[model samples]
Target: MEAKEIIEEKQELALALPLPSTIAVAINGKKKSKYVVRWALEKFVPEGLHMFKMLHVRPKITSVPTPMGNSIPLSQVRDDVAAAYLEEMGWQTSEMLLPYKTMFLHKKVQVDVVVIESDDVAKAIAEEIAKALSISLLLELHLVACFQGSAASYSHFHSPSLPMQRFQALSTINRTLLHTRTGSIETNSSRRQSLDIREEESFMSPCPSNSDIGYAPSQVSSARSFLTDDQSWISDQASTSDAFTESSSGSQVNINFELEKLRVELRHVRGIYAMAQSENIDAARKLNDLSKRRLEEADKLKEIKLKEEEARELARKEKEKYEAAKREAEYARECAEKEALQRKEAEIKALHDVKEKEKLENALVGPVQSYQEFTWEEIVSATSSFSENLQIGKGAHGTVYRCNLHHTTAAVKVLHSKEGHITKEFQQELDVLSKIRHPHLLLLLGACSDHGCLVYEYMENGSLEERLLQKYNTAPIPWFERYRIAWEVASTLVFLHNSKPKSIIHRDLKPANILLDHNLVSKIGDVGLSTMLNLDSSICNINTGPVGTLCYIDPEYQRTGLVSPKSDVYAFGMVVLQLLTAKPAIALAHLVETAVQDDQLMEILDPMAGQWPMKETKELALLGLGCLELRRRDRPDLKDEVLPALERLKDVADRSRDSAPKVQLAPPNHFVCPILKDVMHDPCVAADGYTYDRRAIEKWVEENDNSPMTNLALPNKNLIPNYTLLSAIMEWKSQSNQ
Candidate 1:
């Protein structure tokens, strides 16, 4: 059969079976005695045949007075009794089964005969009621006997043939015995009545005289022998008869009252014995009925248990099915997620390829002959999409990344394309950088206008500001090198301002814009703000405004909102001050001017630069001050004054060393102070006779007041200048600079 049909058939078969009846067994207030009774009933009663409810019986109190005058209220008495019973049974009295009382009245209570062990009064009352109702207890007992495997207990009472005849025989025996006893009592009473009547009749009628009867001694002797066993009773009776005869004047009276009295006592004894036998028969009948009910309950209980087991099995199977379906769903979800991830990766690659193709097409269509054009894909692949490791610098305008392209190293400046004005700036920078070419200026190798990126020759040493002020625990920038860098930047500025068609002013000029190559040569870069002036028109353009880094911006340009060559000079002056002081450009212009006016220029100089040429240092400082003048006309031009003056200082330093005696080039001796190993710097002799740089010795003495060479107290504690060694160092410095 199909599964569905099989299930239906099983259900139909289950319905055909009889449902077990529920039986409630009442326990009369005594819990300890009920345990054994409950156990036996439950064990022998099959679980599927019947279900048993164990109920505790509590007495219902009624308002009644005691034999004493005092009357206790029923509610109070009931509570007290309930509490005591609960204490004994270990139950809450409030939870007692109240319905059992009604069940008892309705004959729904299935109490066992075992209850007699705990409460005899209740058992006696129950048996009396059952007997009065003529309820057959034997049928119930027979059922219990079967379950208990003791059916033999009722064998004598049960008859195979003529089962109804046996009941009839019992009924007849009971009636006959009662009637025989009653008849005996009636006969005795009737004999007594007759005797009384006879006595009364004799008293009123004529009596027989003694002279009419002949005395027979032989008959009298025979009667006396027969009554010898009761001789004393007979003598008493005879004396009484003689007395009666004499008193009645020869009238004879005979009485046997003692014999009649003995007979009446015998009948009363027999009646009492018959009543006791009837009570025993009734008790046996109730016991039989109780056993029969227990057996029926056992059968019903067995059936119920079987049904419960089948239900549990069905539930377990359903749980396993649900878990299997859940696992399948989870597996399907994981597969879908993996597939989606693969599709997303494929889409990204396709997009990257499309952008690359578009850039190559644009390059081929509109190529700038001045420089090469790079595709965005080539740049991204080289720099790994501008990963943090390849990024060299970040700014408001753009990010600079170090990358390799076509076997050549390059710097990629990727401009911010979010703002509309930034595109104009990008084109302007590309225009300016592509046209200009100088050794001290950064070279633009290629441009990608579509992607807003500019490719240029990569500088190995980074920016001038980074080398001078950013590093720690490194040799300082020598005065000559600083002078060289300042001159190189000024020359680049001169070139930008002196171009043929129209001079370009580098609106933004600072140490950051000045980059350093592998050889530490200074290079000017970042011409995004450079604007070409119209030589034909003398008047300034109103569109041009004060736009440059703070502190580097000229005061005249800021106030007038005009672009001029002097504006670049003013910004270059700030860069010069930064080179000299090794401090940031912000507020350095005003601070330097104040120091120069106060004659504290030496105090503000970078000590790490070592001893400077005093006259040359003062001259450079004064030139920077002039460029920073508030009036644009007062500031010196880069081509005429700043560049020429810087070149003169470089020449003078070189000529002085050339005129001195030459010394063999070699590393400094081990005995020399490690701090003052540089050439042309101030050399001084301390108490330990160790030659150290003048500035280094002074700073050490000021901080520790001890000789660095010996790590001990100084005998002279003062540094005396070594003029001869200074002359030799100057010659060596000049050779190194060449």
Candidate 2:
């Protein structure tokens, strides 16, 4: 039959409109690519949606580049990544899609995922969906398509001049099932339904099912009518035969010959009837044979489709194996490269550290600032021979003691056995601390390097890290205090970077090294790990390897071992983030950046730091993130970009502190209601002359006729609003919020 040609003609006008319900989103096995699925779900899933399918198209790679500028076939590559996620070119479709599937399942949505390997992503997706639709519906759909063909075929059969009741009846049947190209074997339920309908039609018609060998009821009716007419004519002829009998004696002889002739014609008619019956039996046998052949062809078609599906699956598995092996080889090559790089870095670091002291000492002309070199006995007397009671703290280089030296309160750092790198650290710290003096830098009083001791003006409150961590139950630092500390640290770093003779890089700038006094004035300390470079506009000094706390280390310096003013900038950025959240320095920059990007800055602000101003806090977060650029060139200059912004925030913070209520977080005891034992929302003077919350006083008056404060019996239940107390309470809350 012309099934395919006829269907294609009809398809020309079928209008293949874009089906929003069947959304096709392009994605891949890359991190964050699931957002495409999310976008499809949010945008199209709500609009009368039916099926949501995810499509991933992997590329086919024959060969990959080698480290030596050579090429290797992908088949030769090793397989070490997860076998399940592997594709021919190392595409990780299933590994990436697991999360997406879980998300869709949670949303109560059904989805089909296609992982295809073809360079043409769009074409692959198109053909895959088409294949899926073709075999899914197994019904009389092809028959539907034929009905849509030329109407003239049916119109010719229905012509009034040439048609009888049967042609009109057959037109209602839409032609025989065998006329078409082919059909799928009917399901048992469908076959039974057809049989039931045929039986019902037989009951409605006068002819029995076996009686009509012809196609329709019209042929059977015509044959029955012709038989009745012929019988009536024969009866009329028999009644006229007796009247003609007397006219023929010779006619009788002719009648006998006519009888013989009639008998011969009957025998001929019998022979023709027998031949027709034999022909009918042959047609029935051929019909059964054709039916069996049709079934076998359908089974073959089904087998072919099944084999095609199996082939596709096999190809997918092979592709996955190839990709996994490719990745394994790539991973191995990367590891080798990394090992070589690390070995080189280690050799450089060892060479740099060995000559570090020499480079620094040679670069310096003797100490610029001079001070008394105290005798060993004097140091011993001041620190009580390094008594534990005198010892206030200890650090990486030394133990510190509170001492009275030269009639001034001082912090004396006694070197811990002064050996190896410890000696160099002490001398470098002493040289830098003695030469430069700033209000925001710890003041160096004197040093006796001979006895391994150095003294400095004492700071009462210890380091900023202690305050932030609330060590020893110390009260949390106020937000304004932290703001000023950030500003002070920035300004001090800039001063060191811009120092006249050379720039000093605080290789280890962290909260623990920042000291605060009784008034909470922050100062930078611990110049032991500090490195000074020769006068150069480049402001970068080559070092062996990165040095400092890993959490606050500059990422660039940690990688390349290049020291610059920007390295200090990177560390200072982390310090600022810690000040804002009171969080640990590790990953603080990432957290703040993400929070700022999501507009969730206020959520991470340290709530303990009373009422942080949102405008200043977000700006501080942004500034901190800007300082933490991974590349040194990308970081903002400490003197110009970071300090100016911090200075403005400091000024705003100062105003906020000034405008805030002086009573810390709570109101004065007079603002408290006697009945409620808490600050009154609305103060009212009771008859007993004590102010109470409006609701509290009313409730008390309802149950008790006496005052709650002095237990005095009330003569009258009259109460007056305490406007003066109410005003004070309102002012307190307003200032506290500001």
Candidate 3:
């Protein structure tokens, strides 16, 4: 069965809700925050008196780190200058409220400004600002008392309106708030209408819809008084009728009947009013339930929106990941392709290099190829099938064996196994080694074609690299010997570079390739990475590819991919520095340069290399730094500038070695002046009374009035002749064969 329900004259009334009493605005003392306050005022601020709470969330000040240095955030304001923190905040609040103060005063608004110093608000400052901009945190809603009513509506006050032309308002209200809160008998007469309203309605215009909603005891009492007054008036009418009834019967009867009808109609109206009020209570209950359901639906919609936003953010991240993955995949594929192409090109270049090496080796063979050749059977017999004990040394080129060949103790170098696959670098090394005849160059004796073995004269020592490091716990090389070794390497390099038709550039110039004999004489050993170029206008050997160790490679050659004689000079510079300091080659130039600039070069010298001669060592270091120039043109010419300097240093080292047994102290080192360190020509004394050269002391006094030896202030610029010291120096020089 279908059931039907109906509400009779119970439709919901369309009435305005209570206006918000407070609009809480959050400010950050920023210009954008003022825009937010202005927007709230223009948008939906109701047509009623309101209180705006200007809540400013002051940021907590602190220090943070940056690239340049540690810095404080916004360090403009000072506590002492601004009186105190509270007063400063007050000033800031006033500054922010400057724009809207006039408008707010005219409107029915009051402001209660406050500054809150809280870290939580500072942390979520962005969120708070957004909430304020959305007006979600600005306005706080409350169900205040029912809205004020006007004269035309169900009003209880009998207040009268003033004359329109005069436009005067006379209000005697206690101003506890904007509107009077207490005192029942308050008078307000305005030109338009009064804002004060009463809870109860007029008896003649009773709104039954609002009868049971928030009705107080006062309203009930007022209703009872109106009913009692009506009853009194009816009783007075009845008494008059009774008096009239004794005098005139006809008129009294008609009056009595009309009075009874009026009483009946009043009772009927009272019954309807009571029933309508009861129904209004039920309707208000139903409306409250509906409002709750609406709020729940709104909450559900907001949750769904949040979920959708999260999903969109996730999808966007996924798209970015996919794009990044695609790019990585493409890059990996390109790298694979490039690696394959490089491997192919390297193979082709290897084949071409082998052919060139073979042609050059054949051309240079002349009579060097006539050396005694050992058969494969003889080599196997001598080495005991290449026994492990017979092996003397192992290197990148091949293995060396101590074997007796042709009644001679020879070092036989054999190529690696399965490397009969003929290579380019080894052939070049063979061609150059077999033809060169320098005492500093390793001598090649013979070869075994079957296994690519070459016989060379045996040297008791290993290589320059091992000797410098003292790899087998050997004694450290003395400074004088290292100086001579540097000289030999330079002169030998000059020889190869000045070869007859074409010049040879040793691409690999490092310590490992230099060999040392029993006498500790160093020789350039490996010639594999070398290339011969035509002596043309071009300085660098640009015909061959660049290949060498990292630190020894010249900067210009590494940048432009060309090999030149100057490149060898650069490597020689690094070698010279290593000999002086005994440090690793990596960043050696930079370290030495910094030391020299700071005048700490003496501190960094190798303590193992027996007490270095100070003057010669400094000169060598300066020369090395000059040779290590970044540009090839800036470097010293190997033949002209460099060779002459090395020869001079070598002569000093040779004299020191040759005269080890002699006590040569005729002209002692102390005879020279402390400042200039030269034999004092015109010896003199200064105010500090130290004997010094006349010119050196005068220059020092001119720049600074201080003693050169003691660094103390001089009394006066005086040069007393030190004739006695001068006579000793002169007699000593003459006796020393000057």
Candidate 4:
């Protein structure tokens, strides 16, 4: 028969009026009544039947108990051995069977199956089965006493689709025992409520108690539903409380045939589970390694970028430094070129001056053959017809006259005697004087050979000595004019001393030869007694006859024939002293003679120069004495006497100008307020000693608090508000009140 037919037969038996623990069976139309008896003893009877005492008890287990004893029939031992084998395969057996019963009222049907379990678990099993079957009727559970022993009442059907439901139900039951109410397990009303009152024990162990259960022999031979080739037997076997329990020999035979089939299915499931787990592990490891490599690559990129930036920064700084150095080099080269240009210009100027001097000297020499000849006609023409008024002041040499030539005014000197040895020296004098044309020196325009004359520029004021001595009867020179004259004379002396190629010195530097222009610019006029300095030599010794005016002559140059620039400087100092004191250098001769004798120099100061600084005047007088020293070496040079004296005069002028009082006007009429007019016109305000009216201010202060109204006294006539005026008034009030 098929598995469906077998399942139908089992249900038909369960639905009978009553069911027994043991049943009689007939197979293949043979009257084998003993086979039923054997089936009862082999499959129906439970082990440990002697342990329970009930209404019916099994007298004893009469069969051979040892699984190794072959005396036990294969049919009786089959399920026991199978249970043992299942335990070795990691499954367990229950100690007891749970029983349940159900009645169909309309059909008057009673159904039951033996459930092996404890009393508390039997009620719960009955409820679970009733709910799954959608049964409304309450299940009635009963325990039965058989001839052999007391047996479980019945087993209820279980659903094959409830594996997940069963696990969740079991967890809820356990949680119920633990008193946790949050579980979501639900059951039909048919479930027994009494199970909640009776504390249920732990779930039963599925392992078999006896080893023989694992090694039992197979029964049912070719029972198509049991020892059959059909697929339904294995599935039907697992659907009920008896997952593989056999009700008869036919069922037992069916279970044995499907054992090998179930084994193959499980092995395939395990292989697939293991392969999936391995693949998951390998994928996880590769992902971790990839992540590590990516992190390292990112760091390397960052480091490279940082190094590139640093290199760029260094290159930029080097470029800036290079540019700066290049600019500095260019600047230095430009500076060097500028200095070279300046030096070249200075050299060119010096050469041009020397050339001009040579040209004038050649012009003045006027053919050396004519040194002894006197051409009166040519001299008259050169001197502009030698008119009577063309005569300037007469000198010891000859008549020195003014002339006009080439539209320029000039001075001419005509010698009285131009023959013999005197003629040769006179030509030398003319050559030397003509070559020197400095702003400080008198220029020799030309010589008059026919009239025995030389032409020179006319002096408008004649000489400084002549003007100062009142010889011209002109206006008296003011003090500032005199100081300026002094400065100009000193500057001229400095120019003469520093000329290149070293022009001659004027043996006479007296006031007579010191000529002034309209602006009072002085020049050293007559250079006839002059001698050209030898630039290459340290000293120039001239033993010629004395050629200078007696009063201004250097005593040493006369006594030792050592005429140097110092000899001229001494004569210049004497002239400066005469100018400063407004005294005649010749009159000072007597004073000098006395000073030289008495050495009481202070007594010699010129009375005309009143109230001069006595110390300065005395020192200057002493300097003049030193210039006229019996020994030439004792006198100060031009740089020491002239430059220092000029500097001192400038300092005095600066101090006097700085100290002079500044001009300020009186407060205007518009500034006069009606209230302040009384104080504004007060005598105190008008006095030079007071900056403002003191008496009116004093009267206002004496009034004390009444002065508050005095603010109205201030004039509103001022164009702008005078904060300074207000501040001064407030300060004055505060001081007076204190």
Best by lDDT: 2
Cα lDDT tens digits, model 2, 1-738, are 133332232233222312123544445546555665564465345554547666666776556567799977756666543232244334445667788788678777887776777775445544664554311111122222332342543322221111122222222232232134244322322432343345234323443322232222122213223223222222222222222333256676556545643553354345335534644665687699889989998999899999999999999999999999999999999999999899999989988987877667756955344566888899999988889988878887788999998888899888888687788888888889878888899888888979678888898678898888887666678898888999999999989988878888888999888998766799898888888877766556554556688878887777777778888898898998999999888777788888888999889988888888888888888888888888989988888888999899999988887887653544567888887889999888888888889999898889999989889897778889999788778876775555
Give lDDT tens digits, candidate 3, residues 113-189. Answer: 65665565523333443343212234111101121222223232111110100011111111122133223212211
Tell me the deviation in Å of residue 290 in model 4: 99
For each candidate, give its TM-score against the true structure: 0.40, 0.41, 0.39, 0.36
> Between 2 and 3, whose TM-score is larger?
2
Residue 251 Cα positional deviation in candidate 3, in Å, after optimal superposition: 99
User: What lDDT is reached at residue 535 by model 1?
Assistant: 68
* Candidate 1 lDDT over residue span 564-669, tens digit each: 8888888888788888899977677788888888888899898877677778888988888788788888888778778899999778755654664443333335
Q: Write the per-residue lDDT of candidate 4 for residues 1-738, one digit (tens) a residue.
A: 233333444333323312112121111112342233233234323321111101111112223346576556435667777456445332221221111011112222222333232334334444444444322111111211111122245321211111212323433433343333222212211121222122111111221222222111111111111111112322332232132234344775556646634653454344334434544564577589789989999999999999999999999999999999999999999998998899899899989999888778977986432222325664567557757866667777667767655566666677879675456556666776655556766766566554356656666557888767756354344334455566666667666666678746667778888887644567777666667786765357876677787767887778778777777767866775676556766667557657646856556544443334545545555655666666666766667665687667656644643554321222333234433563243322211112334454455445632322334433322123344454544443343332
- By summed lDDT, the worst window of 10 consecutive residues in model 2 runs over 134-143
lDDT of 1 at 83: 61
lDDT by candidate, in order shown = 0.62, 0.68, 0.64, 0.49
- Judged by lDDT against the true structure, how good is candidate 3? 0.64
Measure candidate 2: CA RMSD. Answer: 34.3
Ranking the candidates on TM-score from highest down gives 2, 1, 3, 4
